[model samples]
Target: MVPAPGPRTGARPRRRAGGRGRGRLADGHAAVLQERPCWGSLEDDALFALFRKTEPKVQEIAPGHDPLGDLGPRGQCRIQGLDDDRVQWQVEFAVHQLDGLRGQDDGRWPNEFLSPAMVPLGGGLNGMVSENRAWVALPPSCLGRPGEFDGPTVVDASVGNKDVELGGERGERDRTALARAVVRVANGTLRQLGCKDSLADPGKLPPVSRTTPTQMDALCGIKGLKAPDAERESLRRTRVTSGQGGPVRTCDLTHSGRPWSTSVRFMTVEDPQLAKIFSMAAMTGGPRIKGTKGYGTLTPSRAVYERTCRTGRAVFLVEQRQSDRGYTLPRELLPAYAESEAGRLGCGPVEMKMPAGS
Candidate 1:
């Protein structure tokens, strides 16, 4: 597919094969895609379908542009889990990018802007945002499990497939395991941008906050965080029988819908399973845990989507309650982000307002 031009042009677009060449189609895209050892595509057409599709009049923001600038109250975030017979693992990731341009030598343009991106290592689309159909629709094959899933989660990674020694501790084990996965993915994404680089030790990274089910059910007419259809029927039933005081609780779930959604695919070659991982998301959408009311989905506005597609900027996510949306920024990265030109625009401390008619 041919790429239309957007933003500034000092460096020629690099190929996925990793070299400075006139931006051309089918270069590294094939090799880079092949480099991903897991997940087979139905066909080449399927591989490139998402890459070539585009939205009408999409905003043409570049990768270096900051997505946080126009972020909504509850900055969105997501976690992913995958396990094959030989492995079990989880990683948390988000779809945000750094703000603004960079010198040819900056990490954002590492190797002197020769490669399309220093991090993510794929998708050399011309534009960075929604207009960048190629980057947004990156084939599932390009994303591989960064490490061995030898254990149910990294918390148990060193244990390497041992049975959970404790019977009732599975919930705690799952929570911690999911928490660390985000750190690993966050560090991986941070390698490209100099700003907000991950700490040498990933263990220190914080786990994203998850939403409770009751809290999720309370709201009415929120965006992506709608109650499952069955639950909605239950709520209707409660309201009908009990009147305003019905047993049904009222809550509002508001998601930015910016980053879209995330999927988890796990495989194990040792004893059992094998594969790899989409959706447009305001924030990185995460895993599905039982008993949890909210799945941490978001419905970001068009502005937020454009920002995320353009930059792929922020590497991590922070999920908070709709009332606490403005505080969604991860505390660890808060300083660097605040120092950024966009952060300085007073974007911080954004507030999430619940809808009326509960």
Candidate 2:
């Protein structure tokens, strides 16, 4: 594919116009498709064929621009029933530059979507990180529900730090097929942008169930964490989940239910770029975790710790939850959590101690 003119310079005009097709569904939903060639010949017969292969017709919408200047250019479409044309799902496609231009440096894709915070789609092939980009397919309904294996609900493919994400709420029956189509589109988008094809082929994805609640004692075992008060004792619990056997991990503490409340959230990030972003946030101010080879800062709302592990650089975070609290933030909790997580990664010991009562 030839390189197109940059957004700074005038972008090339629309090369072709797609048919404004409409669809109607039995659910009494109707939709209109507005298609404008956002990327010249990149929209080929194969792409059109993929759209037609689905039962519901895809109504293409005009390309969209990001006012925030983070996502450079975008296009969107929605699926609707052929007869009634009621909208059932929406899909988005976008591309950004890699050199941090147009706010590409933001870590939304790398930090949240591609991190362990989100569960893998299936077979672990749908989620991966390479030197150039991080690609993952996630369940759009809820990351907390690991058992939901309809298909790849969300596909995020970022190359050289820039990203192209296809997200939508899809029906259970058609999800797997639609997800493969999205993968093909995403791969095509990457090629059009002159990036390598980093996304793998979406083969038969199996029903995946990875994330699970960790034992409550996971946090209570921390040296400095105080026992929950009698009134809130039963309410205190810990839930843990991680990426599909990847380096990303999360630990959340919450009140069981007596007025559902959140205490603190801990995360370990192995993505190099994301680690850098958190490292920058933690170094701006706040006290460091004593005896740790890494750096950390504690704020009223959160704490961030960065250190090198056996694999590479990693960042750990401890954040206060917005929900009603049932426990206090012990000073030693940060280091204790960090040490425990580091050990899980086979990192050397981190002897941490808070200075005498502040």
lDDT of 1 by residue, 211-323 (tens): 23332332222223224443332222110001121111112122421112101000001101000011122123322111111111222211111111112221111222222
Summarize candidate 2's per-residue lDDT along 267-294 as a digit string, tens digits: 7775443354454455554665555577
**Best model per lDDT:** 2
> Cα RMSD to native, each candidate?
21.0, 10.4
Off by over 4 Å in 1: 1-94, 97-168, 199-358
Model 2 bad stretches (over 4 Å): 1-86, 96-117, 121-182, 202-215, 220-227, 230-238, 255-263, 290-292, 323-332, 353-358
Cα error of candidate 2 at position 18, Å: 7.5
TM-score of each: 0.20, 0.58
lDDT of each: 0.21, 0.43
Q: State how far residue 347 of model 2 sits from its true place (Å).
A: 0.6
Can you give the lDDT of residue 227 in candidate 1?
A: 40
